[model samples]
Target: MRCSTPVPAESDKLKLDWTQWIWPGPKRVFSAIEMARAGQQPWPKSIDYYVYSNVFVLLAINSNVLARGLMHWAALLGLGLSWLALWVAKTLWREPTRRRLNLSSLATAAVMIGAALLLKFHPFGLGPDLERDDRKALTLIIVAVVTLAMISWFFLVLIRSQQIAGRLRELDEQALHLKLARRLASAQIQPHFLFNTLASVQHWVDTQDPRAASTLRSFTSYLRATLPMFERESLNLTEELQIVRSYLEVMQARLGTRLQWQIEVGAGVDESLWLLPPGLLLTLVENAVGHGIEPSLRGGSIMVMVTARPAEGQVLIEVRDDGAGLAAGAQDGVGLTNSRERLQLLYGERAHLTLTPLSPGCLARLQIQTLEPTA
Candidate 1:
């Protein structure tokens, strides 16, 4: 069966209103705040929540020395400064260079100095009545508040930097995987392979051979399955096996009786439940045909097997050929290298691909640990 790609309807496309373009920043900020409040972590218990709460408590405790209006103004100013500090930390996190870090430090120092000046001058026209001892105490309070703000800003920047680094690493891995997928697709559909297959089809057609129609059908099916396979991140074993079967059939048609192949599934194996990186199995089969069988004087049989181990939570796949064994000092080609890297990216250390040389042939085995279906 062929896998069909889904296309979204016209109504499914994103349609933005005028507010989305005009007030995008505020809308996104509010939306994010709402999401944070509704998330698994309690918003009230966050570090920022505690920090701001402490600042307000300090302002309220000293309300006797300062006017009520002045206290409110100071509270608002502190909140605004905290927001600015957070914005600056996020900006620095995106591009954490030495120069940016130095500049942010200077900016933070300037903000603290400005806050002290505002408090001393009573800019809100509601000055605090204080004696010599009271002034000293107020000065100490300002120092403590500044120190707290500075420490909070430092920790905020540190946390943001770590988060940004992890996000960037994930993006880099995804980009590398996509690059390898495209390269493997190109390698599989090389001009020489296509030209050779077409040449065989043309000969059969010219000689009015009966195999011409079936050969063309298999070639069409192979193209239909392969063209869209790499566009996706993964495929179920059933869809991948269809591609493999079509490929083997086309090759068999070209080689005539010299090429023989069979696919075997263990009794408990459900092909649809097993998901794999696209074109992974196809690469192994191609290796078997090109390196293991085609190069030999008498082309031999290729066996593809899929077995599931429910108790062990693993799936084993093997592609074996009773043809020429591995040549001495032969390094892995682009296909095998790309396959290994793709497997590593997908399954980490839980999946392994090994090529063992038998007495008369070569065996390529792949074992993947998977308990549930991962699509």
Candidate 2:
């Protein structure tokens, strides 16, 4: 099964619109929190809370209640408590651990109890005519608001954690599948390749042809370069090119004057500094020879080019064969499919392999985001 392409990294950036303000759903709220955690700017939800609290204060001032001053103070206190709740939620989102959760809960309860006691005792002496029932209702309202906010945040954090775990599992499965595909590709290619080369060598030796020794040497070099590739996950571009060159040389010996090839490195491209999945380029080369060159009456030339755009952090590798173009209703073989899967697993949407039909042939292009080589 083909893996779905991952979302682009830029899609994670917060770009709020009118719809998000009208109804900030869980996704938008979580994105706001993430932006705040990343130390970007204040999230819109925080601004909305402050605005709503001030609006409540205004409504309380305009009311014809007996304890207008008490209502004002209650509004202010609610604002402070809500802000504290938001901070607690942010902290929990950043580090959702049992220890932190317990600490935050204890702290919130302590603050709420202290506030309730202060309101009951009239410590501030701002609302002398406030009644017992009014105080009770006000206290209940504040506690309910704060408690609901906390509950919502806890559930949000829980859901986020579950999503993260699920994504990790998906990645693990993809990695396992990639490994199995690599082994399958190796098994499919090696025996048949060895048999064909050995047959050619045997025929040449029996005919006492002058090309036998050179062909044997090329075959030895190809085997030396190809065997260790399957054991590694990645290799430097220079090493990959070496393997491709060796394979092409062996092919040339077998199909003399029919297969011609060249490798070109563009300026500013340091082949040794760039890395690629093992056998990636060689797979393209093999496909070109098998499908494009060999089927034609007069085989054509193949060119491998490596170019880099450092400013854009992009690398492009093209394998072009001037032979018959893609056959009618042609589909990718196992080697091509495996190569694509490997690239997807390694680079996500940052890398892609595309085959474009040329005027007289086909161009297989691999574009990937460049990474600094590890020391």
Report lDDT per candidate: 0.72, 0.74
**RMSD in order of candidates:** 12.8, 11.8
CA deviation > 4 Å runs, candidate 2: 1-66, 126-138, 149-157, 177-191, 202-217, 227-234, 275-277, 292-301, 307-375
Per-residue accuracy of model 2 over 70-164 as CA lDDT, tens digit each? 66666666676667777776676555444565566667778778878976887455444457656775677568766776566657556555554
- Which 10 consecutive positions of candidate 2 have the poorest summed lDDT? 21-30
> How far in Å is the alpha carbon of 180 misplaced in model 1?
6.0
Candidate 1, 233-352: lDDT as tens digits: 678899889989998998999888889999999988889987777788998888888888889889999999999887778999999998888888887888788788778767889899
Q: What's model 1's lDDT at 31?
A: 28
Q: List the residue pairs that clash in candidate 1.
A: none
Clashes of each: 0, 0
